[model samples]
Target: MLRIWKWYERCLSIHPVKTQVVSSGVLWGIGDVGAQCITYSTARKRLQCKDAEQECKIDWKRAAVTSLFGFGFVGPVGHYWYEGLDRFIKLKFQLRPKTVKFVAAKVAMDGILFSPFDLFLFFSYMGLSTGKSVPQVKEDVKRDFLPALILEGGIWPIVQIVNFRYIPVRYQLLYVNIFCLLDSAFLSWIEQQNDAPWKRRLGGGQGRW
Candidate 1:
C-alpha cells in the first residue's frame, strides 16, 4: 500500500499538467465502472463459464462512453478551472480584501463556473450512453443536476482552497485523485439511481461493465 501511494505520488510529481489531469480523469472513469462491476455485475457471481471468454465480455460501450466523457470533458476543464480559481483568489486577496469576503467571493465564483459544467458533462454522458430521448434526458438532467452540483461543488471548494494554498503543483493530481475516488463512488450511486431498468440490465447492473 505504501509503495502504491509512493508510485502515485511520483506519477503526480513527474507528469506534465495536462498528462496528470487526463490520466486522473481516465482512471476516475475506469474506477466508476470498476466499482459498478464489483458491486452489481455478473463478475460478482462466480459463475462457471467457458474458457474465461465470457468473463472478459463485459459491456465495453458504457465504459467507453464513460471514459470518453471523463477524459475529454472532465480533465481539461478541471485543469483550467482549478488554475482559474487559484488565480482569482490570489488576485482578490491582493486587492485590499477582507479574508471572509475573499473566501466567500472565491467560493461563489467557483460554484457558478464549475457547477453547470459538471452537471452538463455528467448529464450529457448519461444521455448519450442511455439513448434516452432528448426531452427525457434533459428533464432527468435538470432534476438530478442541482443535487449533483450541490454535492460536488460544495465539497470541492473546501478541498481546492486547501490544495491551492498549500499543496505544490506537482502534487495536485495525486491530491485530486484521492478526492476523485470518493467522488467516483458517489457518482456510481447516482448513476444507479438514474438509470432505467433496461439500461441497468444492459449494463449488467448499474452499467458496471
Candidate 2:
C-alpha cells in the first residue's frame, strides 16, 4: 500500500492532471460496477430470481459512460477547483490554511456551490448520454436531484471538514476520488431507483422548483 501510494505520488507530481483524470475515471468505473452489482442484487431479490446460476451481469458501457464523467468533468474540474479554491480562500478571506475559519469556509462553499453543480451535471449527463430528451432529462434531474442533495448533505460536509483540515490542496481531489468510489455507487444506486416509493414521497411534496 505504501509503495503504491508512493508510486502514485510520484506520478501525481510528474503529471498531475493526467493522473487525476485517469485515476478518477478508473475509480468511478469501478464504482459503477459496484452500483450495477447492487442494483442487480436488489432486482434479483425483488423478482425472486430463483435460478442458482443467476448472476449479476456487469454493464461495461454504463461503467464507461460513468467513467467519462469523472474523466471529462470531475478530474480536470476538481483539480483546478481545489487549487483555485484554496488560493481564493487564502486571498479573499485572509484565513490561514488549516485554521478553523479557513476549513469552515471551504466546507461551506464546497457544499453550497460545487456539490450541487456536480450532482446537476452528473444527472444531466447521464440522462443525455442514455438518449433521454431535454424535458425527460429535466424531469430526471428534478426527481433525483433534491433527494441526492439532501442525503449527501448529511455526509459530505463532514468529509470536507476533515479534508480541508488535513489533506493538502493538490491531493484533496485524490482523497475525494477515494470516497467517490462509494459516492459514485450511491449516486448510481439513486439514479437506478427510478420512481422508487421513497423518491416519490421525497419529490412528491415539493412542486417543481
Candidate 3:
C-alpha cells in the first residue's frame, strides 16, 4: 500500500491528468464489480428459491464502459470544475473565502451542472455501449435522467459541502473520485431498476443474444 501510494504520488507529480484518469477508471471498474456482486447475489438467491437453472455472469462490456466514462468524463470534469470553482471563489471574493455562502454556492453549482450532465452521459454511454439506437438512447436518457438527478441532488449536496469546505483545490477531484466509487455502484443499481428504460430495452432485445 505504501509503495502504491508512492507510485501514485509520483504519477501525480509528473502527470496529474493521466494519473487521475487511470485512477478513475480503476475505481469505477471496482464500483461496477461491487454493483455486480450485490446484483448477482440477489439473482442467486432468487434462482435458488425457484430451483431455476441459470448462470449469473458479469457484464464486462458494461463495466468497461463505466470505467471509460469515468476516465473520459468524471476525472477531467471534476478536476477542472473544482479548480475553477476554487479559483473563482477566491478571486470573486478577494478574501479568504471559506464561508458558508461560498460552500453553498459551490454545492449548488455542482448540483446544477454536474448532476444532470453526468446522469445524461452515463445513460447515453450505457445505451450506446449496449447497442441501442440514437433515438433509443435519447428515450432512455429522458426516462432515467430526472430520477437520477433527483437522487444525485439528495446525495451530492452534503458530499460536495464536505468536499468544497475541507478538501484543498488540488485534491478536490481526488476526493470526488474516491466518493464516486460508491456513487457509481449506486448508479449501477439504479440502471438495473425494473422500470429503467435501458433495462427494459435490454430485455426486449435479449432474443438477439
Q: Could you estimate the TM-score for every candidate?
A: 0.65, 0.95, 0.84
What TM-score does model 3 achieve against the real structure?
A: 0.84
Query: Per-residue lDDT for 1-209 in model 3, tens only?
Result: 99988887798889888888888888898898788777777767766765333555778878888888888988877677887877886788664656888888778777887777788788888888889999887766766666667667777899888988888777778888898899898788777664744544534223221
The C-alpha lDDT values of all candidates are 0.62, 0.92, 0.77
Best candidate, TM-score = 2
Q: Put down candidate 2 lDDT per residue, 25-52, tens digits, no spaces.
A: 9999999999999888888878875762
Model 2 residue 7 lDDT score: 97
Name the TM-score of candidate 2.
0.95
Please state the error at residue 37 of candidate 1 in Å.
4.2
- The most accurate candidate by lDDT is 2
Residue 188, candidate 2: Cα error in Å is 0.8
* Model 2: ten consecutive residues of lowest lDDT: 200-209
Residue-level error in angstroms, candidate 2, position 176: 0.2
Worst lDDT run of 10 residues, candidate 1, spans 200-209
In model 2, pairs of residues that clash are: none
Report backbone clashes per prediction: 0, 0, 0
- What candidate 2 gets wrong by more than 4 Å, as runs, is 50-53, 204-206
